[model samples]
Target: MQWTQCITSSQKRLTSASLGAITTLRLETSLIHGKTILLADLGLSSFQLTEDSSSTAFIGVDDFYVAPEFQTFRDGHVQARRASDIWSFGCIIAEVLTYMVKGSGGVKKFCDKRQFEWVPGTWWNRFHRGPTTPSPEVTTWLSELQANGEPYRVRMVGVIQKMLSLDPKERPRSAQVKKSLRGISILSLAKLVGHDLETAYKDDQCIDLLLGNKRFRSWLSAFKRTFLSTKGG
Candidate 1:
């Protein structure tokens, strides 16, 4: 999630990063950063191209981050799809935004009040289906934000609502999310960071941000060397 803050950084953002490395914090930080989803994780290792095909497909995940379709899979109703990852992306985004707007306990409250357990039927059935009303925390924050009529809040809410659609297909693709963010003016973008846009974008720390992660830097160096040798040959 440390990378998430970089993604929202004005001049930097995720222009050259991969989503697979994104944690809950990073996903939220992207919201603060402007839209421009980069798929830098295109490298083979990041895509798990070397993964053993004989390994069983992950059908059931016991984590709270598991998507609704995975829950349905556990119920014997359907199989999980690649799109399921996008759904999990939306949920993580929502939770992060909720935490930001409503304070630390916001997501916790939502999870607690709804009894969001890791069990199969407990999650999707409780949150995705049935007659459960919209969460008051989220609803209240959004409503209050919109009531202010700030373009920043309006645009932010627009992207969030789409990402969190109940139907996975209805949710925006990552590229589309980028497009939406790109459309917003820099002034609106400033509101997300709570200060002058110049200050955030000017931080020199961004240049060496990735180098702080020794493992990623080593892997990147090796990949670069390999690619260069192959090209020369």
Candidate 2:
């Protein structure tokens, strides 16, 4: 199959770059076809694509990836900001990291960890209990990633933590997230080359190293492909 076919295929899982692209580029969720619902799909007719900075008002669907604010006011219309997309991105990142470290079973356990009783005998798998507070279970899961001691995982957990902030204003913007990930990728390349991270940080020649490495270049190419293509969509 062609690369685009593979990415759009329901059978293929989203790469980390693809998840980032969805949020950063603000792509419409209708283009994605998969069992996992990454965004609230109330139907295309109910949703509007706008270019304004203000939040868009819509009725939200009952889905795990929907932001806490969306779920909190399900019975009525809710205004969703770009920060809402950041929250869903964070949840997806957490799951992706879990799968990377512990495989499919780990992803299942991660979901089970988030399931909580919101009402009498009614359970929900949400990152937050309400619009303003993150679930303790989610916090604990992030802590586990921090304690894992792997540099890439630890750095990613840091970004995910910020992305999962309860306050919409507290979440980093898409550009900030991109910068963080770029730094992490550079450090990862440094590690692969057995270069001292301190030196890598202090020197301006790190870009040269990143460009010279074939594997890093390939990864960068894939990221650009995923991000730019999704942006165009």
Candidate 3:
């Protein structure tokens, strides 16, 4: 069983580059970046999927991938493999597109404690940044948007190939994910916030700041007094 939708708390704050990419895409067309939701939450079980089933039906959840579930050693954990991240992103796109084609069906939706989607960049930009397109033969989502006026289906095909490629080196860079799908109406998760669900999550305060209100602040003081007193710092 593949589990996608694992996002890091750090991702809630996007880098300047990530924000820049997203802003540019939005300027070009009223692009919408939706929240990052995992298909696993939908409870869709995986089957011994064949090559054919892979394309039309939902991809095996075991293979479902998203970029953010990747971990950094800073949080006291093993660093996430870049290849693993790319693979996960591929699953996210497939799951979303599949759901659009076939109703919820066997697929499920999930929310990780720390996952966040950038309102700015495609999965490719979320992973790597490049001045030019990375793939010559494999078109990126940005490219598709530039070439044709529509590319919903084309984008999914590329995500599937890169995510499932046996050779990690053969997979496309994350920079190309949004670029290749250029014109397609691959909706962003941002627009869905108030419409689909309501939360103080998208509020003005930083998640950490929100978590550290007056009550939490007192707790932090106690924690520091107990922990810091024990250490020199």
Candidate 4:
């Protein structure tokens, strides 16, 4: 499908002398402004947007991450990885974390001040990529979240791990996943972006049920049956 990107800012790009290619530089910045406005909306900041700096822009990736992790389902994907999905979810977490660290360092009051803008939203019909899974780096982070008491944090970590499962077989269905996320606590991220971890979990349940045809379910049933036999039904 054709790319649908938002416009953040524009700048004249002269080819870089070293790489002889155009790069992300000195275009009217969008990341920081967009982030700031979002943070303000999320109740995480007091930053305001201006006419020149407040606008947003979008662009399509010329290439997807090329990897063996792609799984074709629903619509289709190119060079997709479980980690790609994981990364998408991780970005959501990163936003939450950015809020936690909003006032620190060289960053603006809101991250929106960065020079670029991305939809930061999932692609339409984006589903589990099957050929490969997330790296250990990802699972380690997810484990950290699971070990924590914060519900939203755990859900965030778990959701990413589920999306990035190395063995597609161990991954949860989108619906069962939704159930697992049920009741997870979520707080505001940045200033304007609102997230609901609990609601996400509930919605995940619907997806799980619909994708019940995966062999993983039948295998689980058989494995469990071996451990607990009953009278003939």
Candidate 5:
């Protein structure tokens, strides 16, 4: 679909760096070809845009998804940095991939083990120990892909590894991530499902199928009502 809003503040590389919060990232769903598909929730309230700074610029970050850089800043070890968002994105990808391969609640169970706690030394140790012993979710997902001979799964894992790098500077920028993912060719993935999708299939057409679906519109409306009522109360 239109990645315009799904992609967030990290789209622009900042001159300086700062820690910020992004607790409102959401997933919206729509029916596509008789199946429900998740889309990034890009409501006005979804993203909290802020400029970079040497200090913690915002609060209320979701601990479950907070980047290591933000954790370091919170611990008074470093200045806030936007590259933390890349880490957050990596976490999201990890969770999504886990859910896809392991089925429902996989990510919740994975996070439950960590309890969203990031002890500096312990966390750093685990971060560096990745690849050799990648997260169980990543390892399993890669295995599944390998079994199916999904050519791009390896490349996907590589990009994901970079995003989850322990050092923020080592993480790829948003554009780089986008370019890497685009190179994988969604049509190729679709081929796995026996769909003879053409490379000529426009991205907007796919977005239209998702966003313009009646089920999606209805769900969005109901979701908005529930979300607003909960907030208002």
Candidate 6:
């Protein structure tokens, strides 16, 4: 399904960053089919389209998913790049993964874990603590996700870690992230359907059957295990 429009008339009064956060929550609840979904420009709304139409330039802020560089820009202009979009997509996917493994409460706890006092009374909860460093809490939470050892969770966490890299240049492009996620989904479906990974990946029919089954799709979304229990982080 298409992402819900978060920038409604009532929401127009909200800050752009707040709109982004609302969009993120909507994404968490949306039905995301692994193979068919590819978010190339998920959180980028303030970019200006160039005359070429194929090219665009970042001019303003889209706060909640703003890259670290944008946060530190002093000159009022931030040259947001494609890598910035990758970072935003990474954050979105990370939350989606959290919701998949743990429930919405777990996602809330995850956010709480990232919060810290920026100054006397100001607190920040972005994935990055500074322009060049990731939040320690985010790193720790990722480590916990890695410890789960479930193949899909492990692989996704790895992709997310790269996506949330402090340096935008280090983040993978949208195509790469899409490929990795698709592979992970295939492998997980293989495991779920009692098929070998190779067979699932190579057999188009097998993939189609699995994707076409409503029950399978439902199971995929609702599937949960003892990952990061609700007791605590």
Identify the leading candidate in terms of TM-score: 2
lDDT of 3 by residue, 1-110 (tens): 01122221111122112221111111112222465322223212322223323111222222213233232225544222334435555545554554555447623322
* Lowest lDDT block of 10, candidate 6: 1-10
Query: In candidate 5, how many Å is residue 221 off?
Result: 43
Candidate number that wins on TM-score, 5 or 6: 6
Residue ranges of candidate 4 with Cα displaced over 4 Å: 1-68, 71-87, 94-133, 145-148, 168-170, 173-182, 186-233
**Per-candidate TM vs. native?**
0.47, 0.63, 0.31, 0.29, 0.50, 0.63
Pairs that clash in candidate 6: none
Q: Is candidate 3 or candidate 4 better by lDDT?
A: 3
- Residue-wise lDDT of candidate 1 within 1-233, one digit each (tens)? 23322333321232223323222222322333344443322122322211323112343444444444444454455443334444555555556556656777876775665454335674431234321233444455555545667665566566666655556667665555544445444334434533333344356536444344444446545644553354111
What lDDT score is found at residue 120 in candidate 6?
A: 91
Residue pairs with backbone atoms closer than 3 Å in model 5 (clashes): 18-80, 18-81, 19-80
Q: Over the stretch 141-198, how does candidate 2's per-residue lDDT look in tens digits?
A: 9889778698777878988898888888888766566555665665556566544433
Write down the lDDT that model 4 would get.
0.31
Regions of model 3 farther than 4 Å from truth: 1-79, 106-151, 186-233
lDDT: worst 10-residue window of model 2: 1-10
Q: Rate the local accuracy (lDDT) of all candidates.
A: 0.44, 0.61, 0.34, 0.31, 0.47, 0.58
- TM-score, candidate 6, is 0.63
Write the residue-wise lDDT of candidate 4 on 1-233 in tens digits. 00001111111111111111111111122244432411111111221233322211211232222122334333453332222322333333433433443434412322322222223553321212234533333344345434646545554555545544555455443334333333222121311121233344457866654344334445545644642342110
Highest lDDT: which candidate? 2
Deviating ranges (above 4 Å) for candidate 1: 1-56, 74-79, 116-127, 130-147, 182-185, 190-233
